[model samples]
Target: MTDQTKIRSGGRAARRAARAAPLPDHMRPVRAGLTGGAYRPLTADGMDRIHAAVLDALEQIGLADAPPSGVAYLTGAGASLGTDGRLRFPRTLIEDTIARANRSITLMGRDPAHDMELSGARVHYGTAGAAVHLVEVDGRTYRECGVQDLHDAARIADTLDNIHFLQRPMVCRDISDNLEMDLNTIYACCSGTTKHVGVSFTDPSYVAQAAEMLHMIAGGEDKWRARPFISNSNCFVVPPMKFATESCLVMEECIRHGIPVLLLSAGMAGATAPSTVAGAIVQALAECLAGLVYVNAVQPGHPAIFGTWPFGLDLRSGAMTGGSGEQALLTAGCAQMHKYYDLPGGAAAGIADSKLPDMQAGWEQMCSNVTAGLSGLNMVYEAAGMHASLLGFCHESLILGDDLIGQALRCVRGIEVTEETLALDQMRAVCMGGPGHYLGTEQTLGRMETDHVYPRLGDRTSPKEWSELGKPDLLAKATARKAEILSRRSAAAFDPALDKALRERFVIHLPR
Candidate 1:
């Protein structure tokens, strides 16, 4: 072989070694809680207007149909009940609640290492939503989601590097009983991953039984309260400025049991909410602020995520447009409001309007995920494995989404311009005295792992190389990876004795 051939082979080996090297958590290219308020879809004036509208909506219009207990919670906290039974928040009350709310809170994971510090523009991406069907790997077939599917999705999410948490993403359609389904959802998510899990209850009465299970898993109620890993994804509001009575009761119970709550206000644009983007954000913010008042009234500074999940709609069809650019703007705009209030907030993103994980799905998922992360959304939900506008969940799509989110996070990290990062000396070294390119420079080699994100399933090969190796399909690669991840016994699974006891106490539908 020629000397040039030897040099080329050696360079390739060095690059491989650099890519394989381990990075300290701080040095990694992307991670949870990277500051992101850089992309502001809403201007300062626009935000001021939205905030004013929110206050007006809460005070003048008010929210109707609050549960009896919710009425007490709000009224006790300076809110007044109208003769019409609608709850109106005093402007002073709203301002005071925001002043006393938890500005920064730690969302603990079952394993302490996975804890997320949600404050400011700190970003975390994870799975969420309640899809009823499982999209088969074939991309065309669908099946009703079972308890095992939920467990498998959690396990897959656990192994994914970019997915930060696992919320109950699908319903167990096989379970006929709502209470049983709720219990199994909790057991499946908790047992499948040590990461923070989010679940919802069908009724307020279910909270006591669920708390018992959580306490048992946590070794006691005290332990659970100290570092509560599970949070309640409570949809306390039914949207368009109204309370979901039963869900409000569940939120109350969860707060009483020391569980963190996601005060979700999912208003759809042009439908449940106003047609305009600004109007949608105003309504969502108003609803969540009311929830904040309720939570703080129950106990001062209870952990509640400002979940302003206003979605988009295809105006002509009246169907949900979860993947539209308008949807991205809505999520990003809501994130801006969260930052304006300096509150820990979450919103929906990474949803695919496409029915399958094809080209359409890729662009749609990346578009929203990028905007949401860049806008500094505190908790980015539905960031993976959602398709058909969140009606279907696919494991292969989730594996692929890990790769997609890795790239999105790199964008969120943005360009650093410190003295060392400016690289003037290195530029001088290469341009004046060296090889005239940055291929094998000392700085380039040093930053290979730290500055760049490498895809696990995405192929980046030359056409000739691809032809020689037999071109690989992205979906096919994801399928193989999904199989590999699910085949292994989850490290996060509960201890055998504990699992047996849990199975005996609660009718866990997931097979042992």
Candidate 2:
């Protein structure tokens, strides 16, 4: 070959290599902290109406059944205790709490590279729930969730790029005691994934012990304090204006113990909350604001996620309709309230009403995932692997959900109309000086990976090509991916010695 021929061949080889190379952190089409808020489901006037309703509910109707300490702390901080034993927060108190609440917080992964900032329109998706059953893919059967299953889910989540964090998504039904269950839940998840983990405590006393275990995993208490990788997913309230006393106490203890809290207010609309979408949002906001006040009262500027997850219910059947358009609207609306208060908040999304990972599940997952990201939620829990309306989780479904989340997050990124992105030169070259087409071009090759998202399981081939490739099955691909991910042992950043000590000290159920 001539020297010119060698040079041209070398250029082609370089371009091909670049195309095959992994995308850099900055170039990845979808990442952990993409700004959203392009799709606003609620208008300014609607938000104002909800805000007024929320404040009115807090000041007039108030919340009854505060744990004694919650009552004392809230009342001491300008909330008035009525003769009916209800704790009424003044509008002024709610405003002040919103102002003082920690707005920007980083949920640090044990791997710092995975850390995500919780502020503004930055969105992060993760798995979370209390599903008692596991969706067994092979047999298409439902079995009780166990500690090992929780660990395996975390491991699977760690391998999936779209899943930003791992909250305890299942209850360890095999464990009989509440305290042991809570402790093992923390151990199993944190051991399996270095991403920020969230767990709940049945009682306040477990908070300190869980924190100690977290400190062990984090190298030391001081290190854990500086970059706490764990958060308490505390459901601090019941619907219809009542506080879940034990959960509220657990929230306070979590705050004191240097752990972040997801102050969850999950009221099922048409049952626990008002049937109207607006009314459900009003109830959720009122309750989360109460949580906000409680957190700020306990420790001003404490890190707490405004978790206003108001679920939708099928009024006719009295069953939870987690994947309905109504649920999507509810979550998106709650996200708006979070932004309105200028507080870091989240709601549930990506839950499948279907029993399995089927066509129905795909639609359900995407609709809510897209809407939640666009609504600019800071944290979106239950963003993957949930099915049967939060009653079961599927490992294969989690893998599939990651692909769905990638597409959803790309939507969240929206359109960038920059000069380079406008591609006038590329267009001109193709139309005028190029082969009457832009098939092989510098700009196209350069922007391919950065500008587009490719799915791992989703097929995009023509019929002939698909048939040539053995007509791949998406679920089978997902099942293979799940097996591959779980086959590899988890490599959480804790030292072996620390892991040994943790296992020795705690009632750890999951085998290493």
Candidate 3:
């Protein structure tokens, strides 16, 4: 069949599959938990006010001027190019991109059936588009994580259907000489996923290196340059709370390179911002819009993602309380504003204030992830292993996050209506005979799969059967499932030459 015919057939089959899939146990529309009693839909007036504010922000403040290359790397906050001799992200690229773009995109892979597309999910996580940190191996910790860890992480993400992008592994030991290390790190990590790679265009030279590395991986410069890859430069505009000149320069570089930008505005409500959730959201939106306008001025259609991670402050210790209800509300409100602009929105989900894997962590993470999902965020970041106000990453948290994301996706599947579901013919046949019996009908056997999901984790056994297996909590079952996945996990193999080439790119020596 021709490609067009194949697409049509595939679309039909997908619809049928969607209808056939059993509805999730929790099928009601998820409500965003605001500080008030419950979430109230945005009124027409509220939407208009937000729109006017965004437009005004775009026209008034306007983006800072920077070189085309610098504009290409624009990020959020007050980030600008050329700061202390280090490159920075431009705020303008981010502002402009948010003003335009389709905002919606399906994160599909080899199998469309496995795709999970959101209206827009918030994307943040990287301050400079990628994190630089040390890694723990066995009992000892390593100072630097070259490209090897990056590739490993990429391979793992590639195997999972839920994770969409490859983020640079936390590798912060030496930044001065090993600039290429970060670039290669992002490339290796992103090579495994079909989705985009988030990177920091803080260093223009490194940005060029990353672009070259991507070209090499895609089988030459032409294909690599043509492929769709997502990269955002971040600026911290709002200091204990915004972006500076550094952010503007990075954004400029991103604009020059035609890379997507994210205006990440993160401030602690009640500290950096007002205590009220609505007030915090407004401030965060203002910060993001400032960046958005800059990007639009440089290039109207530059791809951008709206990112708001405004949290509340722990008044006692003056720390950012990422688990506050205000954070969830900010996510939802930002999503509304982004939808108005038809721009992709991003926010934090699965983040916790807890120091470890405990009840607090579970609840906080669940609430945040659910809020983002319900708010129609296109790119929700921090999907796996964030802790202590997003200062640490844990393997167990990553495993738990996979389950959480699975549940969220199931929630978004919505409901379906079909002949098989209603069982009209079976009802008629049985009713005609005075409700005697339809259990033995062929129709029942043929449609059983269409009516049930048969969850792999939830309990459905009878009391007697449950007694035989020993009663266990859902957490225990989830733990067991994680063990099973780890046991069956196999590392992805790559072309030996390609792997060698990728590794060679990270040739900086570390202090022993």
Candidate number achieving the greatest lDDT relative to the actual structure: 1
lDDT at residue 500 of model 2 (Cα atoms): 80
lDDT of 1 by residue, 426-493 (tens): 88988997888988776788887899999998889999998887888888888899889888999899
lDDT of 2: 0.90
Off by over 4 Å in 1: 1-19
- TM-score of candidate 3 to 2 decimals: 0.70
lDDT of each residue in 1-512, candidate 3, tens digit only: 99999998887677567656754433312211111112324666887776565445434443344344434434333444443333233334444445355455443322233233435333222111233322232332323434444454555555554455544435533445556555645555454445456656556556666666666666776654455365664753642323466666666666676566766777777877667766666667767665565666567656666677677677788886666665666766766666666666677666677766567877887776666666666666765555667665544445455655656654544355777767787788888874568764657545454333344455678988888888766556654554565454234343568767766765533211
lDDT of 2 at 59: 96
Regions more than 4 Å wrong, model 3: 1-41, 53-152, 168-178, 191-194, 239-243, 418-493, 508-512
Q: What TM-score would each prediction reach against the true structure?
A: 0.96, 0.98, 0.70
Worst 10 residues of 3 by lDDT: 28-37
Error of 2 at 175 (Å): 0.9
Per model, state how many residue pairs clash. Answer: 0, 0, 80
- Stretches of candidate 2 off by over 4 Å are none
